[model samples]
Target: MVTPAVSGGDLARVAIVGASLGGMSTASGLRGHGFDGEIVMVEAEAELPPDRPPLSKQVLTGEWPLERARQPGSATLDELGVDLRFGRRAVRLDVATRTLTLDDHETVSADAVVLATGSAARRPPIPGIDRPGVHLLRTGADAAALRAGLAATPQRVLIVGAGFIGLEVAGSARELGLPVTVVEAFATPASRVLPPAIGMALAAAAVDAGVDLRTDTSVEALLGPGVEGAAGGDGDAPVAGALLSDGTTLAADLVLVAVGAVPASGWLSDTPGIDLDDGVLADATAMAAPGVAVVGDLARWWHRGAGGFVRVEHWDNAIEMGRYVGARLMARDDAEPYTPVPWMWSNQFGAKFQLAGHVSPDDALTWIDGTPEDRAWVGVTHDGTTVKSVMGYNRNPKVMRIRMRMDGPDGLALVDLLAAESTQ
Candidate 1:
């Protein structure tokens, strides 16, 4: 809880650009906190924003209907008296005026503004990426299109990148009994985030689940029908396969590019006084500029715990940061700085992996309970003293308990965590 620089009573209208989870949470929080300001939510999509986690799992596998993926609908926002402006894209923002310029040339002025535009899936410059058969999953439309592609029963599925999104899609494809091949540039899956040992453990799980996990590989180019060594051309033919860096060709009717995501901060490129180094740079309180705050994937805020700036794309971070910003706007006095232990979960190959706190490959990883080979295990990441993060597979109860203990300022020590586990 941080005291907002601007007084809540002085705010007559608060405009939230992008009706994403973070945006919606801020609106709900402002109203819940007894601020009687006008809330106008602008969304690019016509339909209400849907939950993204299911897009890679249940939604992609057709296990859950598309409707189940939807978050709070219009009725819920209406009850909160939120002026939902759908099908309008925000084009620019004038931080000085706290005004937003929509693509339709409509201007929205507010006393305070919240930017929760979120992020867009990255489609690497690999040729033929825009081909009809290729896909990127970041929005409801992307998920729907990928779902339709999966329904087509392609003979083989090729996925680029072995991050959480790519791996989740691979898991879903496996559930559908489809042959899947995954290519990752790292030596192991999720090496950028997790330690090599943990990545190898996850890689082993994927391999055991029948995924053609190809590590240390990159896609040189995507191939089209009858196009030898050349990427797709002007013709609208779908992608047929991909040529790997190893000079090998893989036949895959459907290609999913899940490399990563880029913050949707392009609209603010020309906006002065706002830092956009990979994302909108903000202070610990999540404030970017006067009367303007950013949340969700678009926010790369300073993390007091990490001693630096970090942009977390986890669903939990979005909700927590949104609520924090919302409450901060209504606060009258100073409160604690926003220092949250990040948390994220993933479902793949019927195993649930949960990670809490910020983890770095440089951190010392020590398995506390069981080894990675076990069905249930827990690992602690620390800088030889204080615990930095905790990761677990199929052990939710223990992982969540340890995660809670990490909330304090001086976080739980590694010795204490291990001692507590030993006593258990």
Candidate 2:
């Protein structure tokens, strides 16, 4: 763990932008670590930060109320003495002066700033993407609207991307008895995150679960009856269907564009010393600039294990990064580099898929137990016999054990570890 030199000062007030999971967690962490200074958490949303993992599963399925997803609830924030500023947006950040400007034309001078603005859903460059009935899941309102839209029991749902969010929504939609059709530009689902073999296996599961999973496909345009075409001049006509690149049209009563996400770094444009390529580029300790730290989905920080700067957009990443940055900010000495074994899970078709460590396309994948067809398998991914990532479907403990072994002093080999486990 490499520790960077952080300056010493009064460290009076810490202003955290974007009061989501990362922001809330940082606030709690600071208070937990004996930071008596003022903690101001700014959020553009009117409501408190809510747990987002359940949005695609329970909330969307109506099994859990939206309020159940609220994190660091108002009571908790009050108990922590956090100056929670709801409906206030941070519009500008000047790292040199260590000042943050809000949308209401107010400026806050802080000893340090934590930019946890997170990321927003990325939509494709298709025509009529802004049309009604096209939805994105990023905020509480977005989830509410999507939930309400699904309550009517739409006939067909067209999910634009085969990512985790898309698959989770598909699972919810399937449980609701709505026909689902997924279109992806890649050959396999979730190829960007999981191994190609595992991605194809998940695609097979989708098919078995009655999902029309279409790969190597692209949505060129979104069509709807509107003022330009409909006779009644109803521009608010619901989304009719989508035009694909292969000259095919798929009818869709609702469309979820879950392509990906980009950092909400527009406000940090004028802020010097901050890299905004995929996200706010931070050092190994999650520091973007002096007295400025970024976390959550919008932080592209250096990872010692990956040997490069990586951006992770999972719930665990947000919590872990927020806590690490908070601890480092208040630590008396230079803190350790923030390196977490990246982990995430997706629940679809009543099956839970857990993955830990890093898995890249270049890594060699070997099945350790079970089979993808059974939806109950454990797999190990290796980079030239050095285990990189362990994946499991409904076998979290197995993957976790493998992840722990990888972190051991003697860098364990996948084959040797599996062989040893077999003997036990």
RMSD of each: 1.7, 2.5
Question: What's the distance in Å from true for residue 364, model 2?
Answer: 1.1
Top lDDT model: 1
Evaluate residue 42 in candidate 1 and report its C-alpha lDDT on the 0 to 100 scale: 92
Candidate 2 residue 395 Cα shift, in angstroms, is 1.1
Task: Give Cα distance to truth, residue 143, candidate 1, Å.
Answer: 1.1
Error of 2 at 358 (Å): 1.4
Each prediction's whole-model lDDT (CA)? 0.88, 0.83
Give the Å shift of residue 422 in candidate 1.
1.8
lDDT of 1: 0.88
Worst 10 residues of 2 by lDDT: 226-235
Task: Write down the lDDT that model 2 would get.
Answer: 0.83
